[model samples]
Target: MSTPVYEKVALLGLGLIAGSIAWACRRDDVAGEIRGYARSAESRDKTRKLGFCDVVCDSAVEAVQDADLVVLAVPVGAMGPLAREIAPHLKPGCTVTDVGSVKRTVIEEVAPHIPEGVHFVPAHPMAGTEHSGPDAGFASLYDNRWCLIVPTPGTPEADVARLEAFWHRLGANTERMEADHHDLVCAVVSHIPHLIAYTMVGVADDLSKVSEKEVIKFSAAGFRDFTRIAASDPTMWRDVFLTNKEATIEMLGRFTEELFALQRAIRTGDGEQLHAYFTRTRAIRRGIL
Candidate 1:
């Protein structure tokens, strides 16, 4: 067999992203050994039982000790403390990356903690289902997905290329962007959608008790789709909203304005306004290509 792309990769947080990475690395021979750690003992055991990693450690520091590549796969809020804990134990030349949704906050929190010789490459994989946890991951999750690399201002070009290649080998298309811009773009495109889904589902739940069971039992596909997104990991979504507050709030304001305009068109029986609005949006999508 050919040599693995990496000697040993450490994963700090064996959730959906971490588990999917482990499976992909093993399938593509990207890493010789995968060491992983989760927040709880039950998760560690479940990872081991599922064959998610070669070794499971009890602590972040222990998991990352000799790893050539360390990927933090926890919630955004946990990145800083985990980075501080693992930095002291990281190998000198190891490359550390993350699969966070927001790039700016993570780089701010994680970059300063990395030691002198360690390389930090902040990345966000634009891929995931509403489901989470190790059980929810599969080897195919990263296949053909776009992974954005947001390197710091002074980061070396060679380091960035190497990290980009790493994601490519995992079956991802790579792009580079400024960390702050990435957060704002994701807020408008990804974050705001999830927030709207959550809101729509919440609205349904809070309706009059007269139709409570019928809401769930006779739900249509559109409402069901909102419910699925609303079921996403609460802790992760909470951190996402909390950490990326400004962008989300700004996007939400625009969203509400647009929604109110649509509502007005319906209330006033203005068919032409609704038709023109949807037509303009469809043209915008056609231009995306």
Candidate 2:
């Protein structure tokens, strides 16, 4: 067989991202051996049965031993503790990375625990489904997606490039970004949109005139899409909002301003203003397409 990206890779959580990474590595022949660990016994058992991991260890320490690359796939709130747990056991020259949504807070919390020799490169894979768990991951989840590699200052270029190459082999296009900039960009592109979706779903639920049955029975595409976004894992999103508070709040304030303008246009029967606004927004959507 040809050379793999890493001889031994360790996955620190058995959630959707981690499981998907393991399966992608297997599919691409990216790693010679994949070791996995999860705090939940059920998740560990499920991963073992899934056969994505060559070995599922009982502890994080065991899983990361001698690993050339270690991926922390836990929730953002849990990443710091997991990093501390695996720090001492990390192999020198190994690359440690995480798949958290927010980068600044993750770098702040997890960077200190990385030993002097181990390289801590924080990353966020811009790919996931509303579904989460060991069974929710597939090899193609990251295909054609962007994976931002937010390496800390002074980290060797070789290390960052190696990670970028690894992600490339996993079918993701990689881009290097700074921690703070990454957080701000994610806030605008992902965080605020999810927040809006949750709020819209909640508003529908709270409308007494519309019964839940009717809401579900006559759900339009807009509402259905909102429900899909709002159905994301609560704990992960909670951590994302909390950890990325400043950037999220800044963007949210801007969002509120735009919302008030739209509300005002509707109240005043300003069809021209509404049409102009929608036309511009539609162009933005077309750009995305």
Candidate 3:
């Protein structure tokens, strides 16, 4: 058997992402020991019972104590305070990383709290499901998914490489990206899509012409997929949009322009334009396949 990527890995949140990380790390022997902590006693209890963590601590500070790699897997808005709380407790040479999708905001929030000798490398695992909580995690959640690593300036190359190696051990493909570019790319690909999904679901909910029962009873595959995306953990998504406002709004504006063009095509019965537009989009889907 190969050596673990981290001797001690600490996860500061017990939600889906963190739980899945623990599960994946254990599955691949990525870490020699996994310790976890959640804000709520109930989540701590659940994590303890789940047994994915070798030791489940009640506090973030305790969990990060002497940990070689500490992962802040909480919502973006919560990372700052959590970083401050655990800063003094992190070992001098240990590395601290986060799984928040909004990279620029998270770097702004969590970077100052990092100690002089410690490394701060932010990463986002581009993988998850609509379900959340400890029960929602599985060992294969991150398999073959991209995990973007955003290395802060002045962070040593060795430290960044170590974090990339750790994620690879968790079965994720790793790539280094600039923080601003990371947020913008994620906004275009993830944040805006989720926002649109939530909006569509809300429109259906408020469409009094269609009864809620009917909406649920006759959900097409498209609408059902929208519902799935919109069903993601509300707190997490809320933090994502709020922290990633600039990029999200920019993308939303572009999406609005495209929507308007489609509306015009439909109203004027421009079948040729519509066909051309859909054919281009169909190529995108085929490329993804």
Candidate 4:
């Protein structure tokens, strides 16, 4: 067998992303040992029962002690405090990375708390289901997915390369990007879409003219998919929007303008305009396929 990328790895949150990372690392034998910690006893218990990590610690301090790589997989809003709490405990030369969707705020919040010798490399793995919690993780969750490594200025190149290699071993394609650019790209691709999903679901819920039973019973594939996206962990999504507000607002503004154009087309009975718009979107979907 090949040598492990990191001899010891610590996962700061035992939720879906953290659990999946632990599982994937173990599956690939990329880490000699994996330690995990969760804020809730229930989540900790679940993680222990699932056997994702070699050791499950009750506190963040315990989990991170002496670990070479520490992963913060908690919600974006929780990263700052967690970083501060673990800063003193992190082993010298250890590398710390996060899986938060928003990059700019995480970098700003987490960079300061990192100790001088410790490396802080912020990462965002563009992979997950609407499902969450420890039990929702699977070894293949990140397989073939894109993992963006957003490095701030002055970040060590060696540390960034090591983290990229680790992600590659976990079956993900890795790319380096600036934090602000990563935030903007994520807002366009992920944050805005999630907000739209939540809004569509909310609109359906408020349509009193459509009975609740009918809404559920007669739901189409499109509406069902929206519901799935909207069912994502509320805490994570809440923090994502809050942390990536500027980019999200910019995307939302563009989305509103396009929506107005579509509404106008429909109101004016412009079948030609509707056809052209849908045709363009359909081609985009095909490109994705």
Q: Against the true structure, what is each candidate's TM-score?
A: 0.95, 0.98, 0.98, 0.98
Model 2 per-residue lDDT tens digits across residues 1-289: 5478999999998989998998899888999999999999999999989899999999999999999999999989999999988888899999999999999999999999998978888889999999888999999989999999998987998998999988998999998888889999999999999999899889989999999999999999878976797988999999999999999999999999998999999999999999999999999999995
In candidate 3, how many Å is residue 12 off? 0.3
lDDT per residue as tens, model 3, 174-281: 988998899899998899999999999999999979999998899999899766889899999999999999999999999999999999999999999999999999
Q: Write the per-residue lDDT of candidate 1 for residues 1-289, one digit (tens) a residue.
A: 6467779999988888988899888878888899999998989989989997999999888899889999999999999999998888899988899999988789889999999888899999988888887778788888999999998876778878988877888889999999879999999978998988888878877888737788878899878866687888999999999989989998899989999999999999999999999999999979974
Better by lDDT, candidate 3 or 1: 3
The lDDT of each candidate is: 0.88, 0.92, 0.92, 0.92
Q: Estimate the Cα RMSD of every predicted model relative to the unseen true structure.
A: 1.6, 0.9, 0.8, 0.8
RMSD of model 4 against the true structure = 0.8
> Candidate 3, residue 13: CA error in Å?
0.4
- Of candidate 4, the 10-residue stretch with the lowest lDDT total is 222-231
